[model samples]
Target: MSTNPGRVKKDEGFLGKLGGTLARKKRSKEVSDLHEEGKNAINAPLLPSSAELLPEDLLLEENAERSMLDPTSREDPKFKDLQKVLIDWINNELEEDRIIVKDLEEDLYDGQVLQKLFEKLSGRKLNVAEVTQSEIGQKQKLQTVLEAVNELLRPQGWTIEWGVDSIHSKNLVAIVYLLVALAMHYMAPIRLPEHVSVHVVVVKKKEGILQTAQVTKELTTTTEMMMGRFERDAFDTLLDHAPDKLNVVKTSLITFVNKHLNKLNLEVTELESQFADGVYLVLLMGLLEDYFVPLYNFYLTPESFEQKVHNVAFAFELMQDGGLKKPKARPEDVVNLNLKSTLRVLYNLFTNYKSAD
Candidate 1:
């Protein structure tokens, strides 16, 4: 009752302190609730939104796909050799003319020589026969044609084999082997020639909406029958025998085609079958075209064509029958003697000749 100013001041100070504590606690609770809400929002699932992938992520995906599709990983020695040979050949060309090496992409893309070399190099391996089932069906169609050709040539001291090299699941490259004995003596078979190769590369295009059958741009259409250096007599023998060889192959092909027209079946009845025919014709013609023209330039005179044709006809007739029932006539009597005409005649004969039992 005596006016305690200190006590009042103390009580006032306590009340202020209590109020400050309660207000501070309330502010702390609000802050804590806000922080918890923020945490919840961050942990919540994001709504549907478009976001661009990082460059590294895109690159990683591409690399993974490339690793799956790359053919260089195939563990075949022949494949490795093919790559090596191509590199070597490129080097050689570069040394000879810098201009040739400059357009390596074009060379790889369009060059028949390099394409053929690549094909032959791939052909050296038989593992290509083991392609996946999807490809096997198409491959078998070509295989039948090859078998027919093989049957025709096998009896004539020629060996034929084939292989398949697939490129990135987009193309199938086929190689048909025509192996002939490089006989030093006419009776004895030594080794095979380094360059007596005829490969038919039928490229089945797998890209895009419409798939087609054609020679892939990577395949070489150029024919190569490089008869390396030979002894004078051996050279002459080959030159003289060349016409007979042509006739033999021609007649055999005619017979094979005529006899096996029905035997060769395909799953699809489209031009895919014709693609096989086209490949066959290309390989066959390619083999003869190079040989036919080069023979004249290398060792034949202008006068030789007529005799060559006549001899070929007679030999062919005799080969058909043990006796030469038909008389040997002049080449003029048989047909025209130009390269173009001769090749045409040979092709026509194959397409037109009647098969004998």
Candidate 2:
């Protein structure tokens, strides 16, 4: 059909504009969708795969677990002070070996420092290697050192609470427990800070549910508390609360003294009064050692208080010379007829020579 050219051109233009409008709208919708998708992606959490977890991520997890389980957190001021004290003590002991422990976990994880410390404190050499580079070697050495430590602690009535794995894993709680036990057993001169405690959240899972509990634990050992009890004077307590027990202990001591003193024709009838003069103490020591204490060294009669003090002090010196630990009793305390002091000295001697013929 014959048509006007201008009209056909207008019609074509109108169709072209309509097509362009539709295409623009579709493109704008696609762009908006893509932008929304990008916003969602940015807002969503990115969870890495198990294989994608890095060493640092594992370390962070380990630290978090350790913090949760440890009695004292690393951030605690008391823990820091304790760490510094323990480090200083180890350094002082290992000074001759030229080993310095700056970080307890890092330095001790390898077991080299622990080996040296054990040797120094125990005065016995371990069969482990001086240094180990491999993980297996380090673990083996740790096992050996810890075995020796356990053996040493056996006689002290202490049960080991740490393992080679725990120690090798850089478990601070286990490490501190071991060190404190060693310090207490070897009688380390430093005083461990006491009553350090913390509340820890214990997490458990059961029946597809997570459970948590708060527990309080003391970081320091009860050895110091036990020592405080001993320092309160058990004999004094016995005398006040249980005189019959006191009489029994005194009778046992008297029998022990007379058994050793029978060679010198000395018998202790009154446990408290006889030892006050210090004559029996010196003679008892001489008899126990199978040596005659020269009469010139101690007063036989002890006419004055000064002479009594001298005699008792000389007897304590003899006790030390005989390989007995120094008693906590003072010479003046013994001379003043302090039953506690007298009993303490006699008890020490009795404990040592009870089996002697």
Q: Give candidates' CA RMSD values in order.
A: 23.8, 14.7
Those runs of model 2 whose alpha carbons end farther than 4 Å from true positions after fitting are: 1-72, 200-212, 221-325, 328-357
lDDT of 1 at 96: 32
What does candidate 2's lDDT look like per residue over 1-357, in tens digits? 798999999999999999999999999999999999997676334322111333433344321422244333556777777778789889989998888899998999888999999998888888878779999999999999999999888777876768887798886767877887787666564556766665554444344333345556576744334222236667757866998888789889999999988888878898767888789999999989999889999999989777888889999999999999988866766776667778999999988999998
Off by over 4 Å in 1: 1-134, 164-357
Give the TM-score comparing model 2 with the true structure, all chains together: 0.49
Provide the lDDT at 134 for model 2.
98
Write down the RMSD of candidate 1 (Cα, Å): 23.8
**For candidate 1, lDDT tens digit of each residue in 64-114?**
311111232223354334334334544443343332433322333222323
Overall local distance difference test of candidate 1: 0.34
lDDT minimum window of 10 residues, candidate 2:
45-54
| Candidate that would win on lDDT | 2
